[model samples]
Target: MSIKLDQVVKVFGTQRVLDDVSLTIAEGEFFVVLGPSGCGKSTLLRLISGLEPLDGGRILINGREVAASGLHLAPEQRGVGVVFQSYALWPHMTVAGNVAFPLETAGRSRSEVTRRTEECLATVELTRFADRKPADLSGGQRQRVALARCLAQGASTILMDEPLANLDPHLRGAMEEELSAFHKASAATTLFITHDQREAMALADRIAILWDGRLLQADAPEVIYRRPRNRHVAGFIGQGSIVTVRVTAAEAGTAHVRLGKAGQDVACVADTQPGTAALLLRPEDIEACGDEGAQLCGRVERSVYRGGFHEADVAVEGLDAPLMVRLAGRPAAGERIGLRLRSGWLLPA
Candidate 1:
């Protein structure tokens, strides 16, 4: 089923939790709602599942109005199942029992329930643990049980709210891959929410970034990362060193930017506005220069080894902000060196 939010808004007391949000999630697509804490990402999910009422606007599924001015659908009627961060499984119920609960609630026959329960367990690769209670299972096992329960419910649309937050790094990565594969196999329309950029980039077919209860941008992961619409989106999507510079002059395909105290014009992509501009240059894009190189120069302030690469802190003149450049080889402190900025993005300072 396709999910669509049309000017959706949610309010509590006087606080607006979701602000004029509108999105369209295609059927069978894996969509991710990404944002920081208190950004209303969960609230948006609840609105879709009909667990919360919208203050205004409408919600449609497959072109039919599901939420509007005063009307709302119940959670079960929406054909949506949600897996929460806490795993929310019952300790008293066996794995098969928990998986069967949803079907039982819908009044399915005993034989049919048993068949579906087994199918769900097989989907999660937990068929052997079906008789075990939640208390006897590890965290990852319990999480799989939760996923199996949702599958047993026969929900065609899924809403996962920070589902992998409880797992360790290694397990989290494994679960992400599992979830991606499951989504492909089930062909369910999924809306997965998370604060982790890696998770968002990895699991999402398209990502919608939210901040302060507002929808900032929605696009494919690479597009959002490579060409952020504003300064905030650019800074939020990935790790980078930001610098303030002046757009001294701009021509056809490049801009001559002046880094204060650093001296001279550095050629960069002509995407900056006049006057003060903010340049976002990823550390990996910066290179150390030898005797014959670009005019950009810096004094290596410090360097730290980060397992794979060395992170160098360089101080360039004219610019008050420090630049963080990533180098393969470590350059010692106080070392005067020439630097070449390979690629960067520009925004209004």
Candidate 2:
């Protein structure tokens, strides 16, 4: 089932949390809501699930108005399954029982519930742990039990709220793969919320960013990474640096924005009107070069070892802030170097 929000608004006391937000999630699409704390990510999920009433605006699921005109459907009546951030599994019940509870609650036949439970457990590769209680299973296994319940319910629309926030790094990676596989196999329209940028990029077919109580941008992962719409978003989304400049030349959808007269310039993927703008340059966009052949030269202020690369902060002449460069091997402090900037994103300044 597809989900649509039109001019959605929510208020808490006097502050508006979700301000005129509207978005569409196509059926079977994996859409992720990306945001920081207090950005209303959780509130948006609740509003869609009918757990919280909206102060204004309308919501439609599968072409039916679910929340509007003083009418709202209960959470269960919305035909959507929610996987909470916490694994809401029963401690006394076994995995199979937890997975089958929803089916039983919906008054399905015994044979159908048993068959669906087995299938759902197998999909998460937890068939062997079906008899184990929540306390006896690992964190990942408990998460799978919660997911299996969602699957057994046969809800076409699913909402996940930071479901992997409690797992370790290794387990989180494993769960990400499982979630992706499940999405493809089930073809359920999913709306996932998270503050982790890496997770959003890994799981989303499209990502919608929320900040300061508004929907900032919604696009493909790579598009949002390569061409952010503003300085705030470019600075927030990735490990990058933002440099203020004036766009001097533009061609073929690329803008050559320069810092100042006799200062360095970098080409960015942008098509805005030429004026003051901010350029976003990721670590991969920069390369080390000889001082004479470079557009930006600087003295190494510091170098931090980051396993695969050294994050070097360079203090360049004429630039107000130090430029951050991720380079192979560590460079000693006080060493002079030049940087070759391959590309960046230009956001209107």
Q: How many clashing residue pairs, candidate 2? A: 0
Candidate 2 clashes between residue pairs 3 or more apart in a chain or in different chains: none
lDDT of 2 by residue, 122-171 (tens): 98889999998999988878887888888888888989999999999889
lDDT of 1 by residue, 1-349 (tens): 9999989999999999999999899999999999999999999999999899899999987777879998898888788889999989988999999999999999999999999999988888899998999999987888888888888888988889899998889898888888987887778899998999999999999999999899988999998887677777888998777788777776664666777544344444555556777777777667877747756778888889988888888888876666787778888899887787776666533
All candidates' TM-scores?
0.92, 0.95
Go through the candidates in order and give each one's C-alpha lDDT.
0.84, 0.87
lDDT at residue 285 of model 1 (Cα atoms) = 65
